[model samples]
Target: MKMDLGDQGLAGNAAAGGRPLAIEARGLIKRFDHFTAVDGVDLAVPEGAIYGILGPNGAGKTTTLRMLLGIIDPDAGLRRILGAERPHDVAHAIGYLPEERGLYPAMKAYEAIAFVGALRGLPLAEGRKRGKALLEEHGLGYAIDRQIRQLSKGMAQQVQILGTLVHEPRLVIFDEPFSGLDALNQGKLEKMIRGLAEKGTTVIFSTHVIAHAERLCDEVAIIAGGRVPFAGPVDLARDRIRPQVRLETRAEDGAWRTALPADARREGRFWNFTLPESGIEPLLRALIEGEAGILSLSIERAGLHDAFVAIAGEAAARALEEGETEERA
Candidate 1:
């Protein structure tokens, strides 16, 4: 039976871009004995978007995902998946790839994909057919008949990813999806995610790697210390701080230096600072009149890494760095 989720107004009716949400959670809490693994976490994943859950290891990302998938019920709060209050009721429309990946080592690649599809109610024959086609499209056709144990580590991961899609789920959730893949395979996975969103599939993946989220996600939730410090469009997060300015000049000291912001620092012959609130035009005029030989001037917006530090604090950011170091190891 579907439990009443009450009013959904808290998470809002739609995403900042006006797209309908595929997943909505409000004040979600989970506990393990006396340990509170997740504390009042909330998420709003827009439909047909590439959403990212970003954090360090053990920041409750996995626990929150489990709750969203209905693998475990939250101790408090509520969620809706694909318009259903009960996530399992719409299980047919969801695909999940957990952080702990496993497959029958003895099973053939194609058969493994088909088996996964069968678990989601797809007919075996059709699943096999689709699985073979998917492998071919992904350049794994030669491995279709190869046993899972016979394939390289990267190939095995590719097969598992294909299995997740063989059932053609409307919403796909991945927990630390890039955990074990090398750079090449990671790039391949990023491309695959973009393809899914192009086909109107909603894809949510959790990762500690900020670059992947920075490149691929439409919106993201930054989870740290078991709570979300930031959520919504990726640009909005970066926009919390001003764009950085880099000015290269032939003049080392001139009247133009006075026009530079108070925070401006001299780095050899260059001036680096945050763009001032009054904007750059006045600064440009000052530079020209003062004969400060401008070699080059550029403005760069803050990237997600910088935004994450600014929003989630240095401690959480350090945890993120340590998690990344461990992943690299």
Candidate 2:
């Protein structure tokens, strides 16, 4: 559900009352000299929601996050985290994992996690205690004493994820958090992201990899050339892109589905076509006669991959504008 930004706090994220907004941004804009990296952006996330930010490279996502973290200031806009001014005042309530993750290579894994917790204002003793528990929970307890360098790449990635949550913040933002992991580790992290949101902590993460965001975020904002092309529930995002649907007639061998239209693109024994919202009635009739060889048929909605391509294509055009301007200059 969309959250109202009338109040902002962990509780403000709730759909109503002083409920938490998890995270909310309004009129968010940032620029570099003559260029705008992020145009006007607005986002609303309720408590216990997993929201994703999707955009092509140079879409101003990083800049937006940086401004929220107070690492940089936006030229215009407002950001609220757990109901407070972000970064400077709201730092304690937010956990952040940047796209470029790093840890002290020589530090012990446990120590690094604790150190992160401490930075978030947790006491050393408590941080260490919780840090160990987090590591163990993520299947990293054995690596507590190991140097960060000693851990494999995925292990180190897990440590970073653990550290991001050590302070128990009400909101967490992870950028490209799944970039380098293998399938197993990716699944593990996906579960963890869901678990975090389930516990009333709003989660927002960014990725160029649309599938990860598609499966994770309850709502997403796709930006291009610093502007929002689509924002809202993932379903809405897919709808906004409005790509073709694929109907796979799972038939085998030489015999084709007599009912299927001749226009479908064939893959192996299957033919694919988009089922229009109005109805697939006309097409269904065509498929009936061809139904003899039809083993099965399924309608698959346009996935996030298609959404990204559709949305990003517009962004690419806007970014290309800059090149044209520069050449003219």
lDDT of 1 at 20: 85
Error of 1 at 267 (Å): 1.0
lDDT by residue for model 2 over 267-320, one digit each (tens)?
A: 665567555555666656655556644456576667765766676685564453
The TM-score values for the models, in the order shown, are 0.94, 0.77
**Per-residue CA lDDT of candidate 1, range 1-329, in tens?**
33334675345547667888899998888889999988888898999999999998989999999999999998888888898878899888899898888889999999999999888889989999999999999888999899999998878888998889999999999999898889888989999999999999999999998999999999999999889988889999999989999999888888778999999998887789999999999999999999999999999999999999999999989999998899889
Which candidate gets the maximum TM-score versus the true structure? 1
What would you estimate as the lDDT of candidate 2? 0.74
Off by over 4 Å in 1: 1-13
Clashes of each: 0, 19
Q: Cα RMSDs of all predictions?
A: 2.1, 7.2
* Model 1 whole-model lDDT (C-alpha atoms): 0.91
User: What TM-score number comes out for model 1?
Assistant: 0.94
